[model samples]
Target: MDLTVLSYVIYLFISIVLTVWVARTLSRAGRVFLAQVFPGSEHLAEAVNHLLVVGFYLVNLGFVSLYLKSGATTETARQVFEGLSVKEGVVLLVLGGMHLGNVFVLNKLRSNSRRDFAVIPPIPPTGFLPEVEA
Candidate 1:
């Protein structure tokens, strides 16, 4: 196979592998975050974690497939390495970006949930009333 074809093959393999690894890592940790976000709802956390993993796979794999096109010919070993580096680097950035976005959104949900449950009386009782015989 020519160097260009070789680079495509290598890029696809690395991109797919990296995406899978990141998805798994996020799924594992996301459960905990989701649990905190939806406190006292283990099932909800697990379900949300599963949905997030599915969405992550779809978005990232779609990006990889769309980005598989080579920008220039990879006729030499150096070209193959360079092409792979750039392609892999972009994939990594996309993965990191997705992770951060998920975290930001979940944190918002967490904070909102906490606010809903928080209870702070506007003012303390001026005085306690004397107990009367029932």
Candidate 2:
């Protein structure tokens, strides 16, 4: 097999395995955070978590497929390793970015939810004011 082909195979395998592992880890751990953000809606949190995982897979896999092609042809073992490293690095970076983006958006949602549930002082009714003769 050509070095380039081997690199591509290894890259795809590693990238896919990493993606699945990360996705599962996030989904499992993020449920608590999602539940907190949703507040009294564990079902909704789970649903959202599932949807997020699906979307994550779609986007990341699409990126992986699109990025499969290497600019330079690999002939040597060193070149194969180098190519794999670069490709894997990009995949890792993309995964990290996606994870961060998800966390940022979820944090915003949690913050907003907290704000929505914040306590507010009640105002006195206008009609409760005593009338004074002029």
State which candidate has the highest TM-score. Answer: 2
**Tens digit per residue, CA lDDT, model 1, 29-63:** 88777888888889988999899999999999999
User: How close is every model to the real structure, measured as TM-score?
Assistant: 0.86, 0.88
* Model 2 agreement with the true structure over 55-83: per-residue lDDT tens digits: 99999999999999989988899999988
Q: Assess each prediction's global lDDT (C-alpha) against the native.
A: 0.90, 0.90
Give the C-alpha miss distance for residue 132 in model 1, angstroms: 33
For every candidate in turn, the CA RMSD to the true structure comes to: 5.7, 2.8
